[model samples]
Target chain A: MTAAEERAVIDRVRRGETEAFEALVLDNQKKVYNLALKMTGNENDALDISQEVFIKAYTGLHNFRAESRFSVWLYRMTYNICVDFIRKKQRTPVSSLTYTDDDGEYMDLEIPDTRYEPAVEAEKRELREALSRGIDELPQHHREIIVMREMTGMSYEEIATTLGISEGTVKSRLSRARQNLVSLLNSYGTFSKSGRHKTGKEVEGHG
Target chain B: MADCKKYMDMISCYADGELPEQEQKLLLAHLDGCASCRALLSAYRSIAEAAEETLVQVPDGFAAGVMEKIRKLPRRRSGGWKAVRPVIISFAAAAACLALVFTVSPQRFDFGRNKAKMSARVEAPDMADTAERGTDSVLMDSAVPEAGSGEFGGTEAAKSDEESLFLYEAAGASADVETPQTGMATATDSPAPNGAATDGQPVDSTSQVTRHPGVKLGIAGVDENTLVIYYAVFTFEGALPDHVTGVEKTDRGGGLYSLVVTADVARELINEGYTNYVIGNEDAETALVYYTED
Candidate 1:
């Protein structure tokens, strides 16, 4: 939806037209979810944060001020929530020990890849996994900036606004973040033969 | 024969189209002569391209799940107090405990002060010289050329709009000049132009510098990241100065405006006058105009 349409829906929701919020949620959920996923590096946390963002936006609708784009405001909330979540997680270390099921059998926790499909080609999966690992290795702040700029396509200005920083800071941080990611990817040997072959195949497939 | 290190620092800006025309041409020329820089640029480009091409799909029912939670939220007027109460209580309790402890053992407070004094005593000699040099640099950096005073000696007050724009743009470009990552902590620690006294200890020299009249946003104690975030919020809120020049919108629809103010306006805001006015609050009609240390 256009900004005007989004504003209208927000106005409706403010006026107790509760269903109107669904429009805003539907329009933004994918981007919000992706942002959370990128930051948290897990589907479950991403989903949780995405839901929390919409809920917080709904409840805190009055403070939004409409000074910035809705997406920028929403992303700011998402960024803060994710940062807090990460910090909280850091403070409390989780046990790696598996939980026993009702059958009294220990079950290995599996990382569910909801996006996985049998038809997905090998090269694409390898590249995605490599990129994901590279991204996961970054400091939380750097990762957030990269996801905001590169994945979400936020301009340096929007990012500065959302993250509450100057454009210069945004540029410097993003440049450093990218450099770090490149280094991480290099360490993974992704710049080598198999990776290069996959990349060529991936390019050819796109072409 | 431009320095490779300098050009390397600028490659990202060049790639982002953030470099001015002259700098862009200069970087392009350097790229032709330097093979290593070319490879670095290629690496950066590949990373950027891969990032752009890779798409992360949202899970099914993501919106529905969000909507379901939204429906469950109590349609209350304001939940701000409820959300903040726990934090407020925790802080209050901590403060009360500290007060109780201080009341019982007043000598403890003196011990703390003594400890601070001892540390300050150790650092005093070194800090004094650093402060003096810092002030000199601040003056040198902010000295604008006087109008009709040839090319080299007046404050920004003497410069015309075009001159102001040119100087400000040049400053902005150089402001992004990369330093070693380890340099950032020390860089931020350099004395603020206002020479804000730390721990209530007065720095007499701070008073010698002329204070420009007008609204001054004190940035002495705030951390760099917080300052940047506040500036962004101010931009979104549209709280910046009125006369801004050289407005350029980024590819993602945020504005970069050069905040040009005469010397007489205010000394603090003019410290790093230019702003990247990313987004403005539609209702508030204000832009973020917080200054960063040049």
Candidate 2:
């Protein structure tokens, strides 16, 4: 539906119509689910977070102002809920004392290349998996910007507004997040250890 | 290679298609000679592409599950001002409140970590609505004597307390007020609530609010017409009982809180020896719920 039609449906739902909300749930569920998955790195957690995002959106619809798109609003809720979950998860018994300290500096640790294989397909798999793992392991600030910008496709302006930071900060932080992810991927041997040999040509075929 | 370090942030913005034309050109020039940066940009693209393809199949009947949960939620229904005219409230403890406000007197307001300043606020969109709809509120009818006319029954103690007091648009809205003294009646506008309309004076919303909880927060009312009053500056002598929602450090900092209360919450606090510590009137403005464990 067009944005206008979506807003009209929201108004209808606000006035007590059930069907309008049901349709909204179906329309936006996939993006919401995927955004959650990117941030949490687990499908089960993503599904749970998706349901909560919609529930919060429905109950707090009155507080929503119309200046931004509903999707941005939905994504803001998704990011905040995901951050809460990550923080809670970090606080819980992490199951391994040797992993990292309170700062969760496991991202800075080096991992052996036990998972790496020489095959091209295996290399690609290793890269994607390492990327996901690296994203999960980054500091909270880095992970947040990467998830918002790279995973959710938010513009710098949208991100700055949602996060209440300057566009300059967004640019610098996103740069720093990418830099950290690259280093994390390198540590996991996702890059060829011998001179870091993967070239621009290899990645060009991805698009 | 170190020069490439400076382009790192620009590289990120470029990857997101956010770099300005001039900077993009500069970065392009740099990337031509730097094979590593090219690979990095390509890797960035690959990551973006992979993320786009990372869709998990949503479980069946997800929307149905959401709808079912939504159906169970209790919907809140409130009418606009025109329909709901019973939005005014009167404090039954106005006279008793006036008498005891002076008892606590004033201590140096260090606003210490161990001290929890309690306050409450009454919310109305505007006084114009209250003036138009408060007819059903007989308590409101008796309160609000003529504004700016010398009808105040305040004492020397009340006027002296007004120096630290500032008028607030709403009762208890200010958390940092060391003295909770305020009023709206009589010769001064210090009595916060009951004095808004004594001789049917139309409360001009444009009037500066200088409400203090110390003078007389009598008949504090709101559009709910739920009454709102705020008084904070509590000093608790002991640990809060379990029934008391334990010493939570609010987001602002430790040992400071402002709660908007209803008659029910006030009554609950009253049952817990709250009267000995502070004024525990049901529907109180919470003139001063300053709690601190010694």
Give the per-residue lDDT digits (tens) of candidate 2, residues B194-217.
Answer: 323334232221111223332223
Q: How much TM-score does chain B earn in each model?
A: 0.29, 0.33
- Give per-residue CA lDDT, model 2, range A101-195, as digits (tens): 22222222221232334247666666667777777777556666787787677889878765656788888777766766666677666754334
Model 1 Cα displacement at A39 (Å)? Answer: 2.5
| DockQ for each model | 0.13, 0.18
lDDT of 1 by residue, B1-294 (tens): 225545643777776667778888988998898655665566666556667556577777777777676565433344221221000011111122222223333342333323443233223233233323322221112233232322221234532332332232232123332211111121344432234233332222111111210000111111212211111112212334233321211111123222212222221221122111111111111122333222
Against the true structure, candidate 1 reaches a TM-score of: 0.49
Assign candidate 2 its CAPRI class: incorrect
Q: Alpha-carbon error at B285 in model 2, in Å?
A: 19
Cα lDDT of all candidates, in order? 0.45, 0.49
Interface RMSD of 1: 12.8
RMSD (CA, Å), candidate 1 to true, equals 20.7
Clashes of 2: 42
